[model samples]
Target: MAIVARGQADRGPPRDRCGDPDLDDARDCRRDRRAVVLPRGVARRRQAVDHRRRVAGRRGADAARRAGDGEPAQGAHPDGRAVRRRERHLLHRDGGQPGHAADHRDRRHPRRDPRRAGHGHPGPARALVGRCRHRGPRGASRMTADDLVWILPLIPAVAALAMLAARGRATLVWLDLLASLGVLTLALVIAGEVPSRPIAAGPLRADSLAIPFLLLIGFLAVATSIYSNGWVRHEVAHGGMKASSLRYYHALVQAFIATMLVTVLADNLGILWTAMEGTTITSAVLVGFHGDRRGLEAAWKYIIVTTIGISFGLFGTILIYAAAAHAHGAISDAMSWSEINTIASRLDPGIVRIGFIFVMVGYGTKAGLAPMHMWLPDAHSQAPTPVSALLSGAS
Candidate 1:
């Protein structure tokens, strides 16, 4: 490096000519800065705008006058204020995108030329160039209907996990309330989104049939969570409900809600049956949580009957799977209800009819349908108030 005498200590950093009042004209500054320092794409757009002005000049004063009227109307918008008084308008409200933008794009792909009729995109507020670029806040993304399908069940499942770290009974109750409300919020969101467009996220999906049950689960969960706050405090005060067991009860309730959500959202027949079985296990534990002889007896009967019915359902599922596989070949998509329904006529009729009977018995038992309806009353009556409400609303 060459040594040189330093400038005066008070001298500030060098300013470009754009900052100088005497030398800077807004139009000239933009043109120079745009050509030399602007990115390649923006420079191309500027060149396109200049070409438009040159063509307008050739069209006589009337064309130029008409073009100027369409530009924005604020001093901050350089193209607006400077056009009539200082210089010709060189930009549009749409961040300087010319009327021939589609034409320009078509020139690059000779075979395709399509013009879009749309509302003019507003320009940036502070920056005098470029299109409006609105992005979601940092570290967040748009949550779609498809995302909510899986997220709904996960909210309560996560709360169940969170319960393990909780200390006080009040904290557990509040956690339950938040989780239930969260599930309700997701259900409402899914309800809004699914009606307009069906959402399918791999193993989980939402359709017309599932929405009502999901909403009921959500509503009942929220209502039960709120009601349990007072009811649980009373049980601890008057009844023999151990203060220590409240956390587990709340956790099991969330897990119960999770199973219900999983059952509703499952797209596969196998997953549905599995989720139903999961519901039985969670609810059985909750049914016996009271630690009384009657409660224990109710829980045992509930599990035995539901387990037997579900086993029939499982056999039915396997038979249906076999039918689907024989029709479509042994493939992974055989387990999906939608796929099975698409080829329903091709399945072995005798095996399908038998499987249907087994499945009706299996799921019907849990649903409290006749002949398998023996366990419903005792289990519901023995379970805690919140669980009873859940069983009633979900069933």
Candidate 2:
């Protein structure tokens, strides 16, 4: 009985061993082994819990710091926000902030990011992104035919400054303007029945179908130019553009005029269509020149609508070519307006009607007819008064 009692005492807890009273001492030995292993497992689990608590506490402190600083709480990783905050905090700790120092040593020799501190760029990456977001439309203003008269000359002048240098610098602008005016005057003189070269032999075609249209365009261009000088001067006075932008404006205006004149004088449908499309591109920038919301919107609408209409005209021109091929086995004859009219009776009426529909619809949009005239009022109202005058008159 004494031996049994001693064994039972050595066994430790009964549940810890197999149900064998004789093997109670074995159970006690096993209990002793477990005591050694259990402490290591418990210590490891405690260490894990302690490590997790430390990490959780650090996250909470970082979150609190961000909240107190009025910064966005980016997650635990060191992202752009975190980096910016650290930089700002360092700057503050060094002395107030980076830009606050008047004659501070660091301020005198400021550290700058290469991207932000470029020759022209003077802001942070985020600031640059913001500026890009705020940037307005590409095409803001409507450039008229008269506007081109000034614009085309300036382009060569600017180019000459780089290319021709001494000689070009002396006379590029004046020469270009004079030459453009001379060409325009020659065209008009020829149209007015003044004696000139064989090229002028095409009768002022006075009573011709296109004569009235050509004369109208010419008169409008002249009137618009007179108005533009005053309007542009007013814009400069009102701070609408810098000197550089004004120079660009003047040059583009003349180029635009040249394109319109070409469109009017084009004896071939292909040439007419090409000139009209050129006019659209040149005028688009003028529409958005003001860099305002309304100006940008108007410019966008005008470009899209006119481009779509012109595409239809292009398709019709191709169809006309196809018709001419079918009728006379000649594509070049189809391009000539005079030939097309003369052969109109012999051509497929269906094809002619379709082509005419396209021409009218396409050119009519430019002509400011209803339905497609949605862009017209906005373009006219937002554009400078001179541009509006040309659009109303010449277009």
Candidate 3:
């Protein structure tokens, strides 16, 4: 794009001034003026070389355009290593581009669940996930966040069963506290591992949205367990609660926590609904554990209202499932949140809209939003202090 002009004013336009030393001097160029007009200060021979290169560039550009964008023309580099490097860069930019993907394949085995990836194959992020796994002791693979997903719901569940089989109040209390501590520990560990790849176990997954809620539940469980021990003892001493109620109370508390944990971790829509129902059941009994008229009334109201609302959620779940089945022919995991989301654009909009409305209302009622929160006030009022905290903070 450089332009050079002759000193004479009569010169029509600027001429190229290529500094090729092999070219004839200005006097020789003047002598050959009859063969071809050579402008002053220009190398006549280099102009021929430049013209030839222009044609080659146009052809090379045509071939390289057949490759990927942002890449140099093919054969632009002399060395084989440089050519390979250019090809690798182009491949990364192309995202494998159908037939061209083999070169970019990861050497490591795939770790991600294909259902979550919208297909039965690793995605561009496969390499990133592999790198995140890093190295473990003696070349053993480190456990990912997904590996611990099943343990979260199990800790409180097992402790609840242990409490039910145990005799003493102190033993049940100890089990309850220990279970809460265990859940908190695991939540912390899993939380640290969560990054670009989400944690997933069959029917269960904890993505970014669920991690904070899970952490809150775990932390609150430990705090409430400590508070419940003294509160339960005081209630019994004051004759406000029966001594026998302590064991049942601790057992129900753990069950309630287990249900909530499951609810938070569930990736399948059906599993989520089931966990919500589990919460309603376990927490309802705990709400009325006092065995009084007011507590009984609150428990009934809470269960009834929540159940009716959840029925809407069930209908919505069914509608969405049917829509997904119709579109994908049931081979896909339509009930799974991840799988459904991957193909969300393909579902019928009208059905999806209506189903999501039902889902919102149902889950919203569970969340205690206005107009659906009629039972919340009474239930929180009648439940024990620790149970009230759970309903307010974790439930």
Top model number, TM-score: 1
Per-candidate alpha-carbon RMSD to the true structure: 17.9, 23.2, 22.3
Q: Tell me the TM-score of each prediction against the true structure.
A: 0.66, 0.52, 0.63
Per-residue lDDT of candidate 1, residues 1-395 (tens digit) = 32232224343333566664544454554444432345567667877999999877766654454478555544323332223322123334335443333323332332332233212222222331343234466998777668889889999999999997898987998899999999999999888888787789998989988999989999999999999999999999997588888888888999999999999999998799989999999999999998899999999999999899999999999999999999988579899887898999999999999999999999998988988888888998988888898888767
In Å, residue 313's CA in model 3 sits off its true spot by 0.8
- Model 1 residue 91 CA deviation in Å: 33
Better of 2 and 3 by TM-score: 3
Overall local distance difference test of candidate 3: 0.78
Residue range 109-159, candidate 2, lDDT tens digits: 234333444222334533232233233578876743334333332443353
Per-residue lDDT for 258-342 in model 3, tens only?
Answer: 9999999998888899999899899899889898999999999999999988898888888899888777777458888888888
In model 3, what is the error at residue 268, expressed in angstroms? 0.7
- Tell how far residue 60 is off in model 2, in angstroms: 99
| Cα lDDT for residue 208, candidate 1 | 84
Rank the candidate models, highest lDDT first: 1, 3, 2
